[model samples]
Target: MILDILMTFGSARKNEDDCQFNGYLEDYLQLLDNREEHLQVLFQKVVEKYPNARICVGLRFAINKEVVSNQIIGYKDAFKLEGKALIRSL
Candidate 1:
């Protein structure tokens, strides 16, 4: 089976409070899982929470110990596509 992972990273907005930012991150972390359903949920949540945040998503997979990876920046740009299409494009 091919395992897919979603990694989210970003900085808090200037006017944002640290507690709030940390809470958001904690929520994001809790939402992570190695399933398409979780990924779709994450996509929607991130879009709603961090519309202008600079987010990067990295995808990695291994084939015979050889790892292949790709990363995309800009939350809006990456999320423009839905579900599997987003993963494919990234």
Candidate 2:
């Protein structure tokens, strides 16, 4: 099963006209920064509802008409830390 969470900051017409690409980029980055927390919550909820299923987290972003996407099946075993530490190390 595929689940998607879509977030829109402003009207497409206005965003296209005003070239609000930077603002949208900022918002997307913020979302990415909080992705781990979001993923953890989603994993816990999904496991509760579908006990035997596997989980994967996908991330996507569009900026100035360019799109980028990636998926993570599971985290690395060596990465014992999270949040700011993980971000700072990278």
Considering every candidate listed, which one attains the maximal TM-score? 2
Cα-based RMSD of candidate 2: 18.0
TM-score of each: 0.22, 0.23
Across 1-90, the per-residue lDDT of candidate 1 in tens digits comes to 111112221214334222112223334454466675666576667767875433333322222212323332334354345433322124
Model 2's lDDT to the true fold? 0.34
Shift in Å, residue 85, candidate 2:
29
lDDT on C-alpha atoms for all candidate structures: 0.38, 0.34
Question: For residues 14-69, what per-residue lDDT tens digits would candidate 2 score against the true structure?
Answer: 43321222222223333444547765565556556766543221222223212223
Residue-pair clashes per prediction, in order, are: 0, 0
